[model samples]
Target: MSEQFERLSRLPLRDDLRGKHPYGAPQLDVPILLNVNENTYGVPDDVRQAIVEAVSREVVGLNRYPDREFTELRTNLARYLGHGLTPENLWAANGSNEVLQHLLQAFGGPGRSAIGFPPTYSMYPLLASSTGTRYIAGRGNEKFDLNAEDAAREVRQSGANLVFLCSPNNPSGSALGLDVVEAVYEASEDAQAIVIVDEAYAEFAHSGTVSALSLLAGRERLVVSRTMSKAFAMAGTRLGYLASAPEVADALRLVRLPYHLSAITQAAANAALTHSDLLLANVENIKVQRDRIVAGLLQLGLTPVPSDANFVLFGGLDDPHRIWQGLLDGGVLIRDVGIPGHLRVTAGTETETTVFLETLGALLERAVS
Candidate 1:
């Protein structure tokens, strides 16, 4: 623990939160950063111009609080999601993390427990703990594949109040099949549990991969979360939203602070949605780079998980931290996801991808020699 942490720990703290490190990826000033799975392609010029104009319109209106209901924002998000969703079925927050926190605040807390499969998004546990929800560490197969039967069995057995299924899961880059979502939801029926499919990276999924959004109809307990951070290239925008039954939105309203989303945030997100096609054009480029990274890793004798998301996770490193540090030393950065013999890297531009693969290949060759 750092001196600051030691002092902070001295003060009274929640038992679950003590000795915890916050959810953060390294925020270093590296030339190429693939560490955080960001959409490094950035916003297209057309969408950028639109967002600037929209935000400018909101500047004078900043004197007033943002639309407390975030009405127009929800309308845009609902239309963008396009499974016949309406504003009543949508909710938004600063980020997917906050959107998740809202869910936990509403459905999870105190004696209720939440569960997530391992090798998944790190924030699930943090969100659970912060909300006073007991966190259950669920499991997946040795290869990190989470099958439907296995997933449903655990949900059924745990009787967890909130089940977080991180499809195209973070740090692994593998997506859960729709069958898995269906099975888990069915398993939760008797328990009346809330099944949350965190689809932050949904837009990056490979062709023909169906989203949990398709399963939302009549499944009042099901929630599908998405973010503009990835495909929309709006990480700085901090806009994440969910599609669910209207009742879920009502539950969140009880917990979300009034005027939570600022007017500028609402306007910018609406502009991005208006030009969703332009912003999403770069997704194909990212998918290409992601596949390229996977191929390069395999050629270098590393085992990369086949990905549906905008990043790739790989194993076969004898010392992952050493490899991570070596990459950083070479002015590149990727994630050391704390899995033994594994690390994750976002799909950057073609040029950045080339540099990362080259740097890593050289490091391995040198280590062997």
Candidate 2:
């Protein structure tokens, strides 16, 4: 712990929060950053101009709090997501992280339990903890893919109040099939659990991969969360939202702070959505790079998990951290998820992807020698 955090920790803290670390990916300064699955290809100039213009229009409104309901913003998001959703079916916050926090605040609390399949998003358990919700660590197969039967069984057994399923799951980049979603929903019926399908990377999934959104028609207990951060390249904006029944969105209103979204945030995200096509233009390029990384790793004799998201998780490393540091020394940074002997790297531009692959190949060559 840092000296500042140590001093802070000395003060009385929540008993459960004591000794717990914050969720973070290493924010390193390097020539190539593949650590977080960020769209290295930034906002296009035209879209940036639109966002600036949109925020300018909101400047006078800075005197007033933003729309507590975020009406127009939700409409834009609903239209973007399609599947015949409307503002009534939507709720958004600073990021998917906050959106999730809101869900926990509303439906998850002391005595209730939540569960997630790992190597998944780290925030699920953290969100549960912060809400005083008991968190259960669920499992997946060796490849990190949770089949329908296995996933449903865990839900039936855990009897959790909230369950998170990350489609095109983080770190491993494997997506959940709709069959799994349906099965888990059926199994959770007896327990009356809320099944949350986190689609943070949904936009980057390969074509023909059906989204959990398709399964949301009559499933009142189901929520499909999405974000502008990943494929939309708006990490700086921190806008995340979800689609569910109107009742679910109504429940969030009880817990969300009034006017939580600033005028500027609403403006920026609304502007980005205005040019959704332009903003999402790079998704194809990123997918190309993601596949390139997988192929490159396979050729290097490493085992890469087949990915549908914009990053690849690979294994077969003798010393994952050693290779991680070596890559950083070469000015490339990737993620060493706590999974032993495995590392994850975001797919960047063609050149950045080439640098990462070439760097890893050189490191492997050195290890052999």
Candidate 3:
């Protein structure tokens, strides 16, 4: 048990959560923040103005509740995704984390189990635990690469009722090909699993990286979840949604709180989607920095995993903590991610990237000579 468990011993805390810690990264007040994989660029002027106007309009109607279904927001999100997706095929929540939570509540419970590959999103297991679902830690092949056959085999072995596939997966920064998704779905036939493709970082994927949305045509068991937090430059919006069979939305309705999405949130998200073109312009710049970080790491004699997301995970640090502390002391903050000799850094603005690379290079030089 954790030290906190003793402090809360008098209360009726859940036994499963005895020693658990909440999921979070440092929110330090530093000059440069390349951790947390957030879009470092602030919202564009036009988009910011649009969100302001939309939210202002909702203030007058604060006395009334938000749309129970968030209909307009769903329509806008559907239009933004555009893989023949309609509002009826969409669902929304406070964030993608909650979207996953709702799915767990609707489909996962005491008798159900959920599975995901390791070194993937940390939230998958946490979300599973929150909903009383068993979390199965699956595996990846060499260098954290998972192929169709290997993934399918694991799913069959786990017999999980729900499966989370984090595309352009977190920390590793690689996406799963559609074949893997297809094979996993096929393998899950006997278990009747609900396969979720977490495309939270899809907008940042490299050239020709396919998305699971293309495979959702007739698959009632597949869901493609997305968020406005990454390339959209709307992390403050806290909006996450999914495209699935219409019946899935109906299932969620039974468990979600009334007016879970507020009027202000719907307005702001709808406005942001209308200006998605301007918002996505920032994604191109971030991708440039991502590539640059990979190349810079190579020049520094470090190994940067190939990435389709806005961050890079690099290895070869002699003492990971020393380097992490060195960077922090230099006024730049990145993620250690608890991996030995490996750390993850989000691709920030050009200036931020340059400083990070330069700062890290200096530290490496000092460590050697």
- For each candidate, what TM-score against the reference? 0.98, 0.98, 0.98
Residue by residue across 1-369, what tens digits does model 3's lDDT show?
465667787688888876678898999999999899899997999999999999999999999988897888888888988999999999999989999999999999899999998788989999998989999998764477899999999999999999999998898998999999999999999999999999999999999999999999999999999999998888888999999999999999988999999898899899989999998998999999999999999999999999999999999998999999999999999999887899999999999999999999999999999
Q: Please list the C-alpha lDDT of all candidates, in the order they appear.
A: 0.92, 0.93, 0.92
* Residue 292 in model 1: lDDT: 95
lDDT of model 1 at position 58: 90
Off by over 4 Å in 1: none
Show how many residue pairs clash in every candidate, following the order shown: 0, 2, 1
- For model 2 the TM-score comes to 0.98
Instruction: Record all residue pairs in model 1 with backbone atoms less than 3 Å apart, i.e. clashing.
Output: none
Across 1-369, the per-residue lDDT of candidate 1 in tens digits comes to: 599898988899988778888878889999999998889988878788988999999998788998889988899898899999999999999999999999999999999999999978888998899999999998764577999999999999999999999888887888889999999999998889999999999988999999999999999999999999889988988989999999999999999998899898899999999899999999999999999999999999999999999999999999899899999999999998888999999999999999999999999999999
Clashing pairs in 2: 94-238, 168-175
> What lDDT does candidate 3 reach at residue 50?
91
Worst 10 residues of 3 by lDDT: 1-10
Per residue, candidate 2 scores C-alpha lDDT tens digits across 1-369 of: 588778978899999998788888888778999998999999999999999999999997789888888898999999999999988999999999999999999999999999998878988989999999999988765578799999999999999999999999987999889999999999999888889999999988988899999988999999999999999999999999999999999999999998899999999999999899999999999999999999999999999999999999999998999999999999999998889989999999999999999999999999999
